[model samples]
Target: MPQPAPAVQRSGGPIAPHLRRLLEFVEPGREDVCLDVARGRGPMPAALAPQVRHVTAVDAMPEPPARADTSGRMSTIEFGTGPVRITGDGGPDGDRPAAATTREDRVRHPIGPDRPTIKADATALPYRDNAFSLVTARFSLYTLGDPDDVLRELLRVCRPDGRVIIADLVRGNLAGPERDRIERLRDPDHPGTPSIARLTEMITSAGGSIRRLDVFTVERPIEPWLAGACDDAAADRIREALLDEVDGGPKTGAKPRVIGGELWFTQTWAHVAAEPIP
Candidate 1:
């Protein structure tokens, strides 16, 4: 199984501030319908709702789907927190049990008011074509297969003149050795991290007119990452897999030439905004 994301580290402080500043270009008012592709836990939807008529949160796997409130409107949707209770029989009153019957599938209760979440994939959206005025994928395109194809799909569903925005990690600024390490670890599905130039090419090739492109990085401490990785064994596997690269090429406790100081790795990201062909 793939490893879970590293936990949030308070030591590095909040990384969103830099991201929020870059998001200023996406005006909520100009949008009527918004779609968040790979909307992991719904934070983007909550951030976007006030600016658009409505927002749809879609993900490949939504552990516990977020439900709408009594009025069918939620201030936020706390998604990916954990599994949902199968309200029916397996456990009580003769209800039909859910497919996920194990304890690993369950988690603590939701904590905030949020929007609804739809379990779906990015490349194949369930909604009809021309359904949204804006589409945003924050730092998610790295793992997608054929990101250009994903952008094409986003454009396929976007209204003419509607916008498609993608934010992801960029590798342009890294040192030669660091860049080499990243390239080596990247798989086809992962595509490694992309540079701003590469990002622009992908969007342009997908037939969207580029509106704006931005580059940014998040500063984070290494401690929380170590802890979060501990949650899943796969994370340990990744650490073991990369030891040779990280430890200066094969069992050398000495640091790699790329990483010079206390800061382990610099998280790089990019954002691109484009519009459908009119």
Candidate 2:
């Protein structure tokens, strides 16, 4: 059997810059308490600890074993020394069996113990109302039960002037060819991605006002990179299919080709500042 992918860390890649951007919006210098919802491996909390008075990292996934790979992309991404408080008990679910899961199951991002985490759902956070000055969710809303409900919960725990930051892939974020592959691989019952308009509605309904809206375009020619990671058989098939796409002629109702090139993914964010309804 092939080795599994290592747990993802906050250290780098397309997501790191955008995550930093959102954190800056919170103005760690001004926020008394920074709460990171679904703070996997505590990377973001670790980043915020020095500036914010306190960072409370919460997530449904349990803390992984000590060996879990939590290293960031680079050595220079400062893993701040401030205290991080986590608040969860359960661990993340293990990969499902082949019969039970798809190719996506093999792509796991393990977590580490840099900060506190909890085994609590986002829609029903354990914190009290108005508990934190800033709440953030990154690349996590897609898996939640009801994103609208989760947004409300974020608002519920936020101080009157606190902010709720949501970041995720917008609809049509992936390249056309890759999107088709993702649609096929994703669970049918998975919550559909929320578009920009849909996200605005969710926040407004949750009693928040949008402050900043930004869309990030992530273009990476990563198929070749990933092809190397797959098993020999899978890699051979992928290579052949890619060649077919490049040689485009006629399809005999077969698996279409996947041209390795600038594949696109979206990162849409909504920063909503919560205010008490007077």
Pick the TM-score winner: 1
| Angstrom error at residue 106, model 2 | 33
Q: Which stretches of candidate 1 lie over 4 Å from their true place?
A: 1-15, 61-115, 173-177, 180-190, 228-264
Tens digits of lDDT, candidate 1, 1-278:
52433322222443244434434545555336887775354346656655567776665332454777711212221111111122111111111212322222112122224323554556766667788787887655644345776788888888886778776666564323444343333321244556567777888888887776555444443333434332445444435544555655553221222333533433455556788876
For candidate 1, what's the RMSD? 13.9
TM-score of each: 0.60, 0.58
- Estimate, for each residue in 1-278, the C-alpha lDDT of model 2 and write its tens digit: 42432332344432244345556545455346777766343346666665667776665442335875751112121212211111111111111111111112211122334322444667787778888776777666655546777788888888876666665555433323343343333233434445556666777887777665655443323343333333555545544554565478433122233334432222223433333332
lDDT of each: 0.52, 0.49
Best by lDDT: 1
Clashing pairs in 2: 7-109, 7-110, 62-90, 62-91, 86-116, 86-117, 87-118, 88-117, 88-118, 88-119
Clash count in backbone of candidate 2: 10
